[model samples]
Target: MTTRIDRASAGLPPAAPVRAVHLGLGGFHRSHQAWYTAASPEWGIAAYTFRNTELPRALEQQEGAYTLLVPGAPEATEAIGSISRAHPGADRASWSRDLACPDVAVLTLTVTEAAYAAPERDADSATGRLLAGLRERFRTSGAPIALVPCDNVPDNGAVLRSVLRAATRDDLRFSGWLEEQVSIASTVVDRITPAPTPRDVREVLDTTGLRDEAPVVAEPFSEWLISGDFPAGRPPWELRGARFVDDVGVYQQRKLWFLNGAHTLLAYAGLARGHRTVREAVGDDVLVEMVQAWWQTASRHIPIDAAELAEYRRRLIERFAAPGLRHELAQIAEGGSQKIPARWLPVLRAERAAGRLPEPLVRGLAAWVAHLRVGEVRDPRAAELVGSARAADPVRRTLSALGPDAGADDELVSAVGAELATLAKAGN
Candidate 1:
């Protein structure tokens, strides 16, 4: 019989003081940041689940300890004990109190790219809620703290600061305090943590001999590179293979243009070709060629050494082809409009400026447009853009979704149009 996991069952000491608060309490956090924090036994995380309350409820029931199932040559299950408490995302009182509490020194976020939209004024937005909490902290304790954004967006720290500044522009004192007291840290995070399957849940019981209602499954690989100061203090994350660097741009660009860009391409192009996961899509010759073309074009801009990039590419192939991961295309396909600007547009413009029409970039954009043309799009701007895709010419729709320059470039438009035609012929 499997025993339910809790602090008592696990024979844990009294919960550590909550020194860190995390937004978007999802699988990636369990596999990555929380795992890192678990290395620092003194620091406990008050993790808030995003949108849904079920995970938080389940985790709270388990006393914030759950199993982490890592699939590898020999799969392993380990209990993570970093989370001191789990709260619903809508717990404004708890969120505000945590931010103001002197003990909470770091605030980490994993809300995806879509949450940052119109962050300046939307008091109800994720960023807005963050600002509200920050305001409370400033008023109550005036404590120094770091806000780390662990998202795929480029220069995520800078982007978040700009949004916070815009949101607090009217209050000079608050904005001044923000610049003086807050540290916005950018990060590059990589880990393949798929949504837990029913099989995974049963396996947790069988393998760990514990009934963990909210167990997370991830691949063995994990990486985190952060750049910024932690003013108040921080968990000793470096002990857990996390790199604290002065500049994260190099690593950030490499991840965005390579891993994330390729994922986007596979999400659209691969799904358009009848494949459902990265593993299946990558096995196809056409998709492989498309990925290679994208990497070659994007490699021109990455500042890293060629040898390192090559190794990274090889590792990527192995990671993407990991059958156990089963990363869903539809999950990666979400927020295309928000994602494309960061993933594909920079390389597209750079290639255009260098006097070449990059075929892979064109195809990726066309695939996105084609994706919009077919099914219900899962994006904040979906209503406007999907209608535009249906109402306008294919090339025009591509340009409208991307930018004016894409429309003006005759060669680019022609290339994108050709890709659209090919996708149409494929009945995608």
Candidate 2:
């Protein structure tokens, strides 16, 4: 007998005019960008999913209003109304139309890192889709726009620009327009949003007297550091704890090597230890020690002050152990092939070049090998990774799969092999 969440039921104001477009409309987008934009009532988002229509359909049914549950001693739940429209990825007409609109000042993306690797002409890829939208924008209004990539790739803004430039190299006029009219912004976004459980739905129904099919549950913590220009205009995201920095690289390095690196370790190591959620994994003393050790190795590379790094680590541990945030290891473990190179290899190579063997980093690599051996994790390169894991020289072959010259380092191979032996002996 609960009401469905909509503008009226949630007592929300009328939907704001759509001034932004978001691709990869998922849980993280709900908890992060959309939430930040909620503080700027004048700017609304036209959100589109990558592939699935289920979420978009459900959200559209609810009039793009959904509950955001922040679990704590006193849980906070609010109906988010920043999404003015929700459409499936197949709605290319709407996507192109929206991007072509002169009023749409910014476009944000949460598509995974893998999406960036797709050929720019591959219509199914995120970059391909973006290229198409930009073509539409260029042909129609030729209005300036900001492209903000919210994924975890390093120097995401530059990466996007590079890919788009390569894509449009054949068309000099369009290329010139791209360079002139588009501003690509790099960003560091943080929020731990777990997939909503049925229990969460029931809780939303009980507490708010509304059924929210698209509710997102997240930790109270959130951060967004952006670097670039918005020529057309943008929401005052800074007012909602987002920082506009001159350079996002340092902050990006801190987040990538610290928080995401630890999560990668926890994903592979914790899952091997039979822990499911991050909360469960972080509670284990063994996993906690491993995370601390990994953080120590990664911290050496980040340019942040030691005191601030220590505090960030402390806060990270607390966030990982936050109650009711059932952040799944399986979810994090899905893209090890893409993640390890970004999160671990930088620290590993740096430490190695310094004449130091990073044991914790190596151990995390071993855990990834072990996870691959089990053949449970989902990865775009799963078949190849599994083949390498089960190959004649698994340690070397697996390392080779991760990076071009990784296995060529005999010392690294020997160390990883030894660690793999230890894991096998422990039956992990």
Candidate 3:
């Protein structure tokens, strides 16, 4: 017999008042933020998808209750009851209303790096619509709210502020009000939640006996570090393993350079070696060596202590090698333009300044160039960069992706060129 998840069926209390509005209602948010908010049952979430209506509709159908499958030797399924409403990104009226509500103290976002692009002409963009919602709320409530961005970007709160300010350049009143009323909380979020496969859906049904249409699957590990002022109160997320600190910058950099940088290496270099998923790629000796080299370079720059960094890297290996998680290399490889500057180029520049070529970084850049050359990419800047990736001279092509300073540096250029040649010979 099949069961459905809801307040009545699950024997849980009714959904709480809408205290938080979440942008980008994807699997990561479900597994990470929603899971955290579940600890504070009084602070319900009204989540909106990023231009995707299917998840919104499906979650709404289930009364915002869905199975969260945590993968391990024996995967466990738990029904999450933190969401009060599910909405499509285009539902501007509802978004505005929710934001205007005085009780809605916090707005959390996971709308990826691309959504924050200063796209003024595109009114449908997440940034544009968020500006609209903020404008609407400012007029009605004049209330303080926290904007916690859970994207992978460094200083994400500041990034969100910059994007919103750019989007609202014409409206100084809205911009000023945003400065006065909104507090952007920078966050470092880590979780590996792959898009659910059909097998996962079947497994959820079999385990929970629930016909969940919008189930989310995640690895066993999750971490959240947040730092900022929240004038409007936030959920007691600290109770749920979230660290609220005075500074998230160090943690943010650690995550970006170590975890994210390693992922970028695996995505490009690992995929070049014909591995499709992070698990398979991470288990490879050569790929592991490449990641280790990159980590050695990255660790030199990140301010975390040696023991903590070592522990983090060790945990990363265990997490990445988890056989049940199928995090795709192609998925990680997406948005290389936005991702590389944050993940790799900084380490490359730091290493170069310290008089080191950084072999893993050079090869990673080469892998990205080769990956671009191999086929079509999904990046917004793909057309502009791919042609450059296929340029005749390796240095010229590498410079195009990395920029003019790296181009002007003789040592760095030579290393990049040599790596590109080596990769070419290897047929990557």
Candidate 4:
């Protein structure tokens, strides 16, 4: 008997190239980056998950292919031609052998924001994993490649080196080889593809009954901005509408402030108002206002203009309202400890340094902290910061978990604590 997934293949297509190898195989990778890579005939990316090999195992059984459904005004459909190869990254000993391929130009990463920091961080951080492989290439094959990080950090390439090469500080030769052979690029990736629902499962299956392991459902919008260096080489992602800039920080800020920042607002406030999905929360005028307030407070500092921000919010509302997409607040709010410092507090610091604390932003911070206290919240980063998050001193706790700079001012900490007190009982 065919499973529900296998029995529902209506419009699936064949596989594409296998030039690219991805480290973190998640839904976002399939929906956003892989979709773009599939659009081009020359670029084929192989993906690997961490220890959970369900994605790779399923797709490989289907010959390294999958589907991407765009939930839009009419809901568009197409067979992606992007991924052609995939495996698990925990198979590191063997997988590292494949990295020796000179043509595999971009080693792209979408590992969650939490994974950015070095374990037990200090002046000397973790960069050995990167150094070891690149060093092998320099010594044996003289091949070079670009190490691209597709996460949401400020300077992702810089962070990757700081953690990967600087972690131990024991090997100078490996560090020198990494400097000579490797190129770390920062990329801003954007797309709002939600997790698959039962309806989506049914929608993907047709008369063909073809099952896919990693079918992605998303909004029609997508964007990617790459910077740093593409030493080995890169595909012409520009052909498919990707922007290549020298300073991806501007683009990163654009996506982070508008897309991710707004996502946090909808996740925290929207849920408090009894919304499960972003669409349901944003559809309500009240929840919409909350997000608007968030954007307004954050808008004061982003590089873009108010008009542009307004336009972005309008599109975001439309995407949220689309019943076809079912983005989960639980998922968005999963990494508060990891994301708050880099995503929310940066704007907070910016706004505060200029002498004005945005009320809505402050409210958001409070809500997130309170949510952590509720004990039902499923934030993994919260688990990582268990001790600090529970402390009576909100600023001390927040700064300790988030970073050193997060607790700079007593007034700011107290204000966040006060707002959190108001919203403590609320849950959406």
* Top-lDDT structure, candidate number: 2
lDDT tens per residue, model 1, 73-152: 33556788899999997898999999999889999999888788565657777798888889899999999999999989
**Global CA lDDT of candidate 4, please?**
0.70
Q: Positional deviation of 330 in candidate 2, in angstroms?
A: 0.8
Residue 191 in model 3: lDDT: 92
Please state the error at residue 108 of candidate 3 in Å: 0.5
The models' CA-based lDDT, in order, is 0.87, 0.90, 0.85, 0.70
CA displacement after TM-score superposition, residue 243 of candidate 1 (Å): 0.4
* Regions of candidate 1 where Cα sits further than 4 Å from its true position: 10-13, 73-75, 118-120
Clashes of 1: 0
Q: Rank the candidates by TM-score, best first.
A: 2, 1, 3, 4
Candidate 4 off by > 4 Å: 1-17, 72-75, 119-132, 164-172, 207-209, 384-396, 403-408, 425-428
Which numbered prediction scores highest in TM-score against the true structure?
Answer: 2
Cα deviation at 59, candidate 1, in Å, is 0.6
The lDDT of model 1 is 0.87
Model 3 lDDT per residue over 1-428, tens place:
68776766755578889999998889999999999999888999999986789999988888899888876534456888899899997787898899889899999989877778665777677777777778788899889999999988888888888888877778888888888889999999999888888888988877777788888989888899988988989899988799989889889888888889899899998878889999999879999998988888888887788999899999999999987788989998998988988887888888878888898988888788888888458787888778787777756655656578777887766777787778788883
Candidate 4 has its poorest 10 consecutive residues by lDDT at 122-131
**Model 2 regions lying over 4 Å from their true place:** 73-75
**Candidate 2 structure quality by residue, lDDT tens digits, 1-428:** 66789998999888899999999999999999999999988998999998889999999999899999886523578999999999999999999999999999999999887898655558789999998899999999999999999989999999999999888898999999999989999999999988999988887887788989999999999999999999999999988899998999988888888889899899998987889999999999999998898888887787789999999999999999988788999999898989888888888899889999888878888999999998486998898989889889999998998886788988999998999899899983
Model 3 ranges with Cα > 4 A deviation: 73-76, 119-121, 166-172
